[model samples]
Target: MPTEHDQPATHAEGTDAAPLAGKHPAPPCALVIFGAGGDLTKRLLMPALYNLSSDGLLDEGMQIVGVNHGARETSDFRDELTQSLRKFAADRASTFHTSQLNEKAWNWVVERTQYFAGEFESDDTFEGLKQLLSTIKTGNVVFYLAVTARFFKPIVEHLGRAGLLKEENGNFRRIVIEKPFGTDLASAKDLNAHILSYANEQQIYRIDHFLGKDTVQSILAVRFANALFEPMWRREYIDHVQITAAETIGVEGRGRFYEQTGAFRDMVPNHLFQLLGMIAMEPPNSFDAETVRDKKAEVFDAMKPLTAQDVVFGQYEKGPAGPGYREEPDVAPDSQTETYAAARVFIDNWRWAGVPFYLRTGKRLAARRTELSVQLKTVPFRLFRDTPVDRLTPNVLTLRIDPAHGTSFDFNVKVPGPVMEIGAVRSSFDYADFFAERANVGYETLLYDCMLGDETLFQRADSIETAWAAADPVLHPKDGPLPVHGYAAGSSGPAEADALLAADGRAWRPLVDTRKKED
Candidate 1:
């Protein structure tokens, strides 16, 4: 006899991570991965494929083709992928971590894996891919451009010229492009149009892995699914919303890339906006992919244009973490790029006309936390005005996204035998405490959804453009560069950001997560 932890993992053999019982495997398709030799392929794509295999979500007939510029034998490519997968499995620190690799599932991926070598701009690559895909059993195909931004257009065009994006015999053909869809409004529109020239909107999947967190996906369930929170979700009951995506690590060696794309454009427009859409969207009549996306798009469309007065920018100064943003390698000493940005946004709509939404993101901060907090307005009449309490404890409902996956509500409560004193207590719900864990790199569901032609989780062109439109004013402030304030790397952000909220007579919830721990 063995305890649950001692038993070997199995597919459909009654284990937590195996046999997605009611879920069916995706339709058979060939997953043609561009930039196969890159980090995204090994770090994310491979792990997602492995998880899909483990849970019996990947069709047995599915084939994987790895395309890159370098020459390598198919066996060598498979071996390298296997080694990478094993490294991720053995590392407890990794998202895809596990004590041992699933041999049967891994073997399935390796058996179906193939490799192709050709330059993205060269016609040879697309022609080679077209010929190789012809031999694959399934007519359905997914072209995933795991490469950099520069190659996005050229590769799509090459595929178009080679007739690789065509759907034949009633089989589906799709392409998944990773984001930074574009830096600003102009670039985003250009990119959208460029891609549409080669492939229709329905055939493209603009994926954002950052939105893959369980807490982010559960925003709808947290709101509409609960009667208590839905009615109080509008401008009337809520005071404001705070969206924070903070990281403790500075630009390691990507300072060169960071120099071009600042914190605001890098995050606020896409990741934060997508999360905002999820939090702010109206309840859809159905979860039909298009229906849900339309509601999300509406949120973006309603955003009031941002200006310098409503935004604050910051750059990290040297601290215990390491060198400051400018001192980092490849960064200019006089670089004006912002490492942190905070903005005051408004949705000029019926439900949330006057409500303010504060968003902030930074590379070096006191904590690495990504969460959304909804602080409700205080009661009109302070019932315990004569009590020991100076004022009511502000009611805040927090949906903690990464690092800590949970929902917590802070409200006033009576202290036991404390002479009519009121206290602030948090009633929290954690994913780990309530549900079984899964090996996820945030790419599993997006990959499966793409194979099934579900675009609800992915961004639409209109949403992307509208989100960029909201950030455009801030990105290109009419008056020279918005003054950049400096803060210690280990601090929350510049003091100016605090002023952004303080002016509204509100303050940010502390960066540190304060939750009572009970063993």
Candidate 2:
């Protein structure tokens, strides 16, 4: 294992430089991953941490402590993690067809992994953690709660009693909590209040893994890096924005959890809202946590409060593969839970004054994909008389975040060789074509940010409230009998969804199916 170096050297490649170099360095800390025995830890968290450590972003004194409800010895747990990490590397290697694992660093990561088996609600078990902590001194601590929300308060309460929450003797403390933050507006507030009681707003980092994706983060770069976009990115030049997060898989084995939170809570409240804010927010004064968050909160707060007429909710009815939404396990027979939700929201702001944001997400849809499309308004007047109407399509900038990593811009152009036929041509920039290397995992960036006490991408309490405030009228029980529709599996959502936009003469973009090779 590498000994603690007073000043760790940066990676030789300039591309791998720390995101906020010199502004924030990796703090010497113990990253305690709660629910370490869970699938999330084995599949994502461990692999992410291992990768970060291998990249020289993590410190020599950095340690990872696992807290689990499982009954396994420390050695047995470590071995399990070691095997899982190797399996993760093998999976990654196979998927990307590359051997990028750092064997020496993998061994080091395995060596530093430790486990604590205890009940989160028990104060005594936490005292045991304090005893275990005595050996490591003068370092920061991050409690990563991958567990359920039911345990969120209990675990924090125990941590408070254990004297692990507050900074003392130059040791800083932080906690990372994963979503679904709440089921609704009221519950979200309650959860935020509970978490704030134990940790400061600065200390609590709410993780939304979507915010960490490379393409998603590229939105900032796409808009600001090029002068071509910034000048025309406004309501006057833009028609509307479409944000879609679709999935091909049905509830599958997540039936139980799916029955409780459907697509609205699962995707819209956090992920979709975050994407919208990123697209709509005014240029911040700086890229600091507060500045970016302040801009995002303003966007959410500016959203014209939804009304029933402005919202369209649909629960997936019986499809070719399985039963309808209400038929799912644990769902009430008459439950009005929405499996597919589409809404037209207005950001009553100067930049996006009249433009509508059409957002939608669903399960068992046409394809498995997530993307954001910024469609600019058509040309003020058409000069060509003989060209077909379809030829004059509006320009669009699409950011494909998952199932593929790329961006595309569609603009109108005259046909080649003596043809005045106006037609739209697409120019694309796919990451795969440029970088043969594997894209960094999303969780790694989020985990690294949380450990460094950076909340740039994490959702804040006020933003959460604003999101719910905007979404509540459409989502709440009192929204008054939402309409649910049945759509064929392996097909687009209900025709009603298409009609919802068709009335206004707009249509959803045809997304490529994941099972098929991209064209």
Candidate 3:
């Protein structure tokens, strides 16, 4: 049995080459993408496919069929995507090495891609799609619904009506749906039911781009691969865990969408909870999809129900230079939607009974970063209480997910002056400092995984519902308990969030203060 830990030694270009050591090469397939004319296609999906081609991971026989409502010649579609690829490269130049297009690789991808123009709900459109697939040599097919949430069911129904969902001649068929999987628990369940009606659980892939991130995946390796952290990963030894995902820029033109989906709905139930699951899940028998997902589901099931008092919501006010949430384009002046959210969550399981999981996320905040910090309980000071050294700070192990990728440990260290003084010092490991940074749009790993039938990084139906259940109280508070507070665009968040932790004699780690020092 091929384990998730298996990785192929090398990937060769030709069909005759054996599959790489641990990784099974993706079988020849056609990825039919709906809403190919949208920003997501040009910015993320296409770029990821191109990168896979450049890496020699994409199969030579694979094809990409882009579906949209407008008619365009194949050459015209290729030309437009080419320009988009150039712009994407230029935009990401400062971040990763793969920001620039590999001309040869781009050309290879262009040759294998085609465009189909048709209305998503039309029977003729899907019929035409079916006919196109018949002409290709693809042995597998992946229908990617990249359109708005509303179009998900209609497109999947059309695919089934056109008999595209059925397996043919030993070939497999899979459908990949993008996130905001559902608005809440009820809707998430409904959506899952509808999708499953058309496709089996094994054939569905729910994509959450955050899970594809390198640092996010590292959370698993840090806990399971090492014996140093797991034993101490409990309430007895850990004070609290803080997960913060802050964005410096405001909604940027997504005011309309943000109006319906606030911070709690937008980030907490999906991205943040996924992080929580990774950090809290018990070690699985293996890293395979079923085993790993089972462990993650257990984490969600063990979460204690939340109350209004356990959550705080905030809308960004005008900053020194930026507009407030209401002032943004397409936003209502009296909008009650929250752009910032902070919550204190608890797990009822034995390993984390009393440990509070502090979660926070906001747009137009003081910084653009995503990090997870594990604060260890302070050591007893009976021996050093009378010493000249001042108070000692508790140890902290932080995992930086973006804007920087790596981990750091903060601990007490003696001051070199030998005056019996104690200060906190951080030993950090940055990915870029040690390894070559490649061009990444964060979708490459996900796309590759999907092609290889790996659902370990994808969200399961149960996991989605479990997360929504935990977030229901905040989303639909009863008795007028939860209120949306206000914070300036450039500030951290509402002061009330700080008070949420303060009430427990703890404070949120300062976004600006990377380390603590004892005087």
Candidate 4:
């Protein structure tokens, strides 16, 4: 067992000759994963850490301690993780290349990884964990609670009681909390208050993996780094903003879990609202963590409270060979939980007083896609009204979040002939074309940021509460204004969703990959 004073010098302590030279490696830390044997641990968290290690971003003295209720040997844990990495590499072969996980990197990571079996609420388990942690000589610690919401409070309480949440000298303790922050506003507030009792605001990272995507983060650069777009980002020039997160598959096997967390709670408050903040927030004073988070929190605070009239819910019915939401294995036949959700949100601030922001997300939809589109108001083309051209389509700027991973702008272009016929042309920018593709599980950036103690991409407590407040009417309505509609499996969504935009004299942009089409 390595003592605190005798621990190996960290990657941060050595001369600047390693990979990413001149960049600060994370301080020596022990990452204690609460739900180590779960899918999230195998699928995302471990893969991300391996990639970071391959890139030499991890500290030399870093260690991974996985805790779970089931007892398993360290070698068994390593073998399972190895299999997961192999599967992840094959699954992401097209986008994130094969070089992400190699023999050398995998071996290096497994050597420092260990596992401990423990019940979340048991004092004996936590005491054993404390002894194991003391033997490791990690200066800083990160506690990642990847378990279900029910275990979050208990685990944190146990850690606090065990004195594992303490910060000594310059070393610190941070906790990464996975979401469904809470069911609704009041519950979310209660959860926040409880967590804050054990950790400071800066020490808590409420992660939303969507914000860690390369393109999602690029929203900032596109808005602030460029002078052309920011000037026109206001309500006067922009007609409305539409954010769509669609899925072709329903709850795979977690039907019981999905029943409690429908699309509104599952997608809207966390993932969709994170995108909303990126699109709607005012320019931050600086790019630092607190400054950026403050601006995003302000965006959530400015959102007008939603009413049942502003929202729509739907559930997918059984198609020819597909199972409906209730038909899934563990779900009840009369389940009223919504598998689809759509709403029109309004920010009360001056920059977007009248502009409506449309949000829609659903499972078993037409396509597996996530995108954000800004539709500019039509130009007052009185001069072209007399021409051969019919009504002009409004200009649109789209940020494709998944599958395509890029940005595209729709602009009118004249036909080559002398007729002056007008047609829409799409100009797109794909991330893969410009940068080298690397193995990324989306958690790489987020985990690295957490290790470096940067919370710029994470959600703040107030923001989470504010987002739930905005969606409360849709979740639990007093007047029963919104009806739960139905849509076919593999369809876009309910027709009522189209009516949501139609009522505003607008329509959703077609769900097509512009990269696959010609200009």
lDDT-better candidate, 3 vs 4: 3
Q: Flag clash pairs in model 3.
A: 7-22, 7-23, 8-20, 8-21, 8-22, 8-23, 9-21, 98-439
Q: Is candidate 1 or candidate 2 better by TM-score?
A: 1
- lDDT by residue for model 1 (6-92), tens: 112223222134447666667778899999999999988998888888888877678899999989999999999999888877785
Segments in model 2 whose C-alpha atoms lie over 4 Å from true places: 1-25, 92-101, 317-336, 388-391, 477-479, 513-519
Ten contiguous residues minimizing lDDT sum, candidate 4: 1-10
lDDT per residue (tens digit) for residues 1-519 in model 3? 222212232342532334434554555778999999999999999988776766677777788999999989989999999999898888788644745667877887888889999999999999999999999976578899899999999999889888999976667788999988999889999999998898898789899999988899999999989999988988899989999999988999998999988888899999999999999998999888889999999999988777888998999999863889999998999999999999899998989999999999999888888999999988755455344323577799999998889999989777787476676688889898888776677898888877777889998999999989998766667787368898988898999999999999899888776545444
In order, the Cα lDDT scores of the candidates are 0.86, 0.79, 0.85, 0.84
Model 4: residues with Cα > 4 Å off, grouped in runs: 1-18, 385-390, 513-516
In candidate 4, position 169 carries an lDDT of 67
Give each model's clash number: 0, 0, 8, 1
Ranking by lDDT: 1, 3, 4, 2
* Model 4 agreement with the true structure over 117-185: per-residue lDDT tens digits: 999989998899989988987768899999999998898888888998888866778899999789999
TM-score of 1: 0.95
Candidate 4 or 1, higher TM-score: 1
Indicate the residue-level lDDT of 114 in model 3. Answer: 93
**Candidate with maximal lDDT:** 1
